[model samples]
Target: MAIQKRVGIWIRVSTDMQVKDDSPEHHEQRARYYAQSHDWQVMEVYRLDAVSGKSVMQHPEAQRMLADIRSGHITGLVFSKLARLARSTKELLEFAEIFRQEGADLVSLSENIDTSSPAGRLFFTIISAMAEWEREEIAARVAASVPIRAKLGKSLGGQAPFGYQWSGKEFVVNTTEAPVRALMYQLFLQLQRKKSTAQELNRRGYRTRNGTQFTATTVSRLLRDSTAKGERRANYTQTTGNNKQWVLKPQSEWVIIPCESIISPELWEQCNGILDNQEAKRRPRGPKPVYLLSGFVKCSCGTTMYVYQSSKNYACKRCKTRISVADIDEIYQVYLKEYLSGINREDYLRQSDQQLQEKKQLLEVTVKERTKLAKRITELVDLRLDGSLTKERYTEQYTPLEERMQQLDVIIPELEAEIDVRNIQLISSDVVLTDAKTLYDEWGSMSLDQKRAIVEVITSKVEITKQDITITLAYATPPSSKSREKVSPRHGFMLAISITFAG
Candidate 1:
């Protein structure tokens, strides 16, 4: 007598099948009888109870059966019917190819079909065509319902926008979102009055519907949106092909019912007028002479310091304290030397280098951990094939581990790049310090034009007081003088020196 070939039994019943009382025991009994009649050994029964055949690969026991087939543990597979194996035609054909390449056969007991027989191949092809047609038909029905449902003012499959909540059939105003909408209107008005651009408005903290920080383009879109004006404007174009056009139904064609107004129409118009004026003012003028402290200087009296061109001096509007630009520039240089003296270059470089090395080491460890976890997942898959682990046991153990491994994979690259950045900063600190020193040494020797460039780099602003001079320096960009004087940390990059007359 020829020895019996080892056979693996796969059984699946979708949720609807369970409602109809389809049982795995019935499949197991039939599979057992078929195996016995064929003189085949029943190695193991992999039953995916209450599982859908639509995505057969996701069925726990079905996945185990596939792994076993690939590992050469099972010589043949037996199921109840073609649909029991997979409802998806693509998945069914893929499984058929895998079994064929592995020299394994698939047997459906009720259909009296086996991949080893020519009739079985013809039956499978016919079944696959039917299943694919059914899927396409179901998809078409759902796609056809979308526009009809949307016209009915029903929820059409996406989350409702801010300031609205989904009612049973229509969107209703949400009280909680009302305040946020009001705040957005207020911000838009403020931006307009300040004569600010969209970028400036965003920097002052405007956000989007999703709570994400707003960009210039997003702000512009919101301003032009007719929805905010209590009107629906459409006829918008969505071109799929070059020179192809389709008439788009406007939002006004759907439904226009008033809920609540966040801002008055008068206020909204005023804001729009302000935005238009600001945009006009932002247009480029001819090249203007650069003022050393144009943007940086602030009046001690809490206002912007404006340079008076006729007087050739800087004056605080509120305080009316006038000082020659040249005198302030000289005073700024003296203060820069005092601030540079406080930093110990050798010590700062040593600490920065140590931090860079530590970051690099951490990055290496993270990479190794990610690699180890990935290798372990492959080993777990192999273990399932060798029958050392059941499908349920492998999934329960590997799923969380796989998720953690994916997170580590994303994080490791970010850490490595950060380490590289820190390393560069440490290596270049000395070069930056030397440049600062060179600029300071040449300041007195340079003409007014050259002096202006050096001043622009070293000092941002110079505020003169009755008793002392306060200088604000650029961050990370150091000044030339090397004096070991203690500077207060509060006024970041600031140096305060009492004015003294020559004795």
Candidate 2:
């Protein structure tokens, strides 16, 4: 009787591969049948489930079978088809080389190719090219479907953003988290500061929808995002560069759908206005300012004012204008104090409450908007998997959506604060005075950064021309909310001041 050759049967089945009516077990059975017909004994059956045939690096079973072949334990490795072994033509060729070097054989039952035969080796090369071609074709078809799925407003597939949950086929509003959405926009509008909002959120004991604390950066991003305006904007970013991070894509390619607005366009603009100019001037870290308003001061001629010679004077480069830093500082404080004197705490607090209540209502509707955007991402993934979306398209949309959800993860929790009419304690006028002499005494003891922080909170622009020095502040507050927590010993009123000093 002829000695039956010792062989191994290799089988792999991914979800898409199983759609071919070829389960791993069925492939193994077919391989065994083919081995039986060739008078070969199957020593081992190597199986990989839910594994892609892209590469052998991750397949432990396939690697082990290869080792066995190299050790002369098995004479052949048999699978149903060449592509089932590996989708890449280069990888298949490498496998062929490995089998050839090991003095073993690779046999595909369906393709009827045995690597031991000369004609079979030639057929392997041809089949490999065809397998690669099919993969590219499938990829092309998937890529072509991205705009189609996007136009149809389908769910792309990903974890739901805050205030929304996946409902299998699509995203649905998460009833429990709906209120947090409105509060976020309201907080930004009322506070006009991300750091203050973050502090309030942390103090209110509200966690993100994912149960994380809020940060200034996260709050800033959410406030800037137009999605809060009741529309879905998709495909605005794609993963690029070697490290694979999301960056902006063209606006023309964005998939926008109007669902429901969380914050009115007017309120969004108001909040974003403060958030936008917050980073207009970049300050160098660890550098102490020689002049209190160096970068903060701008020349009317559209150039930056710099401190010249003895720190007391600031000169403009383009306009050749100069102003005394001492004069600018004195007048700025006088105007600031004058502005604070008119503020009635109760009036502003009432306005803040009204803004808060209105925003809370708006945030509730944001749940619907979030669900639509979040669901659209999931739909893209489903479309890609089912051959409606290309991998490139799915990746571009899915990655950026995930990053946005991450931003939401940090923002949603911050919507909760301790600022309701009954609970919040506002600074009384007597307890926190905004007098210039009282501030100067505290300023003498503060660090440069602390001084700068106070200036940033108060001063918006210090413009110097030939005749006068005019510093226009956006708004200033005396010991209020989180701002007061950082700027100790001074806090009171919300005031905008314009102070002018003779140059």
lDDT per model vs. reference = 0.62, 0.63
Q: Report the backbone clash tally of model 1.
A: 2
Root-mean-square deviation of Cα positions for candidate 1 versus the true structure, in angstroms = 27.2
Could you estimate the TM-score for every candidate? 0.36, 0.31
lDDT of 2 by residue, 150-194 (tens): 677676546555656667755456667656766877887788778
Cα deviation of 201 in candidate 2 (Å)? 1.7
Candidate 1, poorest ten consecutive residues by summed lDDT: 234-243
Q: Write the per-residue lDDT of candidate 1 for residues 1-503, one digit (tens) a residue.
A: 22568999887888866735775665666577666655689898887777777897766677788889999889899887889889887788778766766878888754556544333444445655665566568856865775566555555566555555677765565677655555555777765533244455457564556668656555555554434545423323223222345445454444443444555667667767766786888868776656655644555665566676666677787788666565555556665655555567777777777877788788788878887898999999999999999999999989998999868755654564454334434433454445566666776677766756555544445556543465655333222333233343333334446422110
Number of the predicted model whose lDDT against the real structure is largest: 2
